[model samples]
Target: MDPHNRRRHPTTTRLPYSLGCHACRRMKVKVLYPRPHYRHSLIGSRQCDEEKPQCVRCTKGGRMCPGYRDANQVVFRSVNTEFIPEAQNSHLRKTSKSGGLLIESISSTPLLTQPTERWEAKAIGHFLYNYSLAPTKDSPGYLGFLSDLLSKEPSNRQLKSGVLAAGYASLANITGLSHLKRSAEKHYGETLQSISMALTDPAEASSDTSLTAIILLQMYEVCYLREMWQSFHNDHSQAISDITLVPQDPHDKGLVELHRLRGNSPSRTAAADGILHIIHGRLHFNSVGGLHPSRIDAELAFEGLNISSSQDELWCIMREMSESCGKIRAIMSDPRRNMPESAIIQSFDRIFAAYLHLLRWEATQSLTRSYQSYKMFSREENDTHQETFPYKYHLFKHIAHGAMWIGFWCTTIYALQTLTRTSSLLDVQLLSRGWHQWDFNKRLRDAIGEICACVPYMMGDVDQLGLPMVGKEGKAIGSFFLLRGLYVAICVEELTDLQSSYILKTLLRIAHVRGIKLALRPRSRWFAQHGIAT
Candidate 1:
């Protein structure tokens, strides 16, 4: 019964054979039984019975059997020869009579194939389609720069793993696939490990590939990980801080060099800045109750860029907003630190300037403005949207224009809120003399109305005018943008009770439909108008 010294046996039954068990294959031990017509006979192979549980030979010899490889391991190519690019196919033999080639799929050799699993492929594909760069630069989701870098450095395991992790995590959120979620967590852990290992080496850690991987991991966190968001945010900020503080050789740019490594496209650079700012702008302010250090870095990053498009202008407004916020936070937090009314007035003036800029900016985009218009439904015309979407319904030329418009209104409201906060510190008569001409309350209400008007369009629901809404390729991208604006609108004190309730309801619908779990849990302040606390 010794497996190492098996004797040959003769069998007449023409039972088909397969590849051997792990142990047998490793030891070069084959089935002692003979089959003259075996598939692998040309390679002088012996038969593997591949019995259930453990194979008979391994059991008889007290050897542990890992079992045979699954049938999936050995794939057969179709005899019908349709040529495809980058595909492995069988050899062809030319026929003398017809001059046609015949596929020789009868060979025993296995062709090399893509090693990724089916779910992994699906997750990666979904992530790329939504986030990758569009043909035009105006597209909202602009993570395509990561793909460009990935193409160049195919050997960067950490970057690739992080991309897959983000993909898997995002797909899992959308589909509620338990196995995909588990796989996402697995890849996420591996990505973190890879990043950790890479971080130990200064050159590798500062490389563009490494930074891209970290940013991808951050995307996974922002989209899905609610509980870990704060902790991870702090850790990520600290990591960047540590890297930035590293003493650079006089000849080396260090932090500046790391920024340069982000790639050549301004939109790519701006996208990265916008993402970081969003993570900081949204989460950190809630958790830490102050301006995040990374927000400062984002602003500094913005300073280096030249504005070429509306997308760049949007980032510029955001940068200006962040700067205003920092000044207000500093002034309000420390009354004794300075005694300059002019400085405080200047902060207020800057905010109003940014507000004016946003207004002018939108006004100047005549084409985008023409395509995007709003209609307020009357009581007689109101139907189901009467309660769910009682506000205006917006129409757009392109999804990008709609997003920009929503972003504009959201920034307008943000500016109004910031101005109010800043105005509280100074004497009302001092600034209100000139600024009071602009109906701040009406402006606030109008901005909120515009955001509400656009939600149905953004969410792919039909407008009040009976026009079909365009569903963009990445619903998640639209969801994120709407969530940001709506979250702000619902909390505005100027919003009516009915409007606030409708916005909350829309937020809930987005959570269920878009699968962004964060949307489900609104902050306690969001429900104040309903007299309900979190």
Candidate 2:
């Protein structure tokens, strides 16, 4: 009988030759079989293009296409891997006809031996690695409290689920991973359910974990949820209606309570303090000074924290300005109530006082003063008419300095707009001569210009500047700071139709790019009112 024609024993018969080159075969060899993408697999219809140097599949998949091996030298051999213990178990061993070992390749992609861990741990780690804003231990980022809280109460279901939701959502947003995105939505739903349960229990409702979970839910909605923008728009309209038409008491949860609930770490405490001030000053427009006992306490608090002096002064000024604005809003809301002219005059006096303080602060700041001079002297007639942001890109060496300048300009615009409205309410004879000295229109234009110039720096668009100014990792932090100032600039009645269009466009970019839904609220309203497509 011919040796070729003789039937071989079933156990000793060699498999048919693969279409793939040796390198492609070697990269994906498995005892069970090559996965579907490899050539001549029982499970797949794919076949490799046997190119001279290497197969097409390996090259296209970003795998190094090592040249084919000599068929004569082909031999079975054991290949060791640094895969995790579980992965090692998942792999199988097969004996060749020559009694040599055939080792399977676990994967074509290079991977470190990452241990199998809980999905919660992975999710939490992913979220912090990307979203943490804290540049240093001393100055905790906005999401720093999440770390502290999780460390203390690792099993808090509500907080854990919230963190998981945010982590998965952010990762999905960045990588476009459908499974992770679905996981995010699933965790978000679980978190909402957990929070609902927590709210019903009296002890859990006011817990820090619950509060932090609530904060995370807010952040998740702002960063991940697509429908949140429309929801925010609906709520914003209702909010406006409540503020302007209703006579509800100013919402104050009390500073004592906030101080009590503040986090343990300095970073957490500092973040909580800043948040307290922002909620009081911007959200409710309540007076921070009124809540505190004396000027010394506020000053001491500012000094103890990593806050900038310029911001400290500006906040002091803004607290008063916001209070004045709130009072004016309240008065305007109640046309039926007999509000005396003296009360209205008092509010105007406070506004004027804040305006003067703002001017003095600007003059005293070397950085702000130089920037102002540059913007004032650098513009050409053509540039002024073009409705573009004035001045070159100025780098902020310090976050505090950036905040200080942005806050100053924001406060200045608010003051000017307030004065314009207040002047209309007051008799012309009663208007202060000093209010007339500064051209409110020119001042607004200048302030808006300066604020616009700060956008790129704040957004980390100029990473070429070499400052760690809120890069991709700290987008939430940057967006948090940008929202209030940008909204204030956009809302100025003195803004030109051209300027309004430009600023609204900027807000739209921030909403979509930064993934901050709060931005959409103002942008949608502005665009709707202006008859522009949002």
Clashing pairs in 2: none
Q: CA shift at 218, candidate 1, in angstroms?
A: 1.5
* Candidate 2 whole-model C-alpha lDDT, 0 to 1: 0.58
Window of ten residues with lowest summed lDDT in model 2: 288-297
The TM-score between candidate 2 and the true structure equals 0.61
Against the correct fold, how does model 1 do in TM-score? 0.61
Give the alpha carbon lDDT tens digit for every residue of 407-474 in model 2: 66766776677676667767553444655524667877877777777766666665435444443544
Residue lDDT tens for model 1, 401-516:
56656666766776776676666666575355565524677778788888787776677675435466456333565666677677667657677777777788888776656656
Error of 2 at 283 (Å): 5.1
| lDDT of residue 175 for candidate 2 | 61
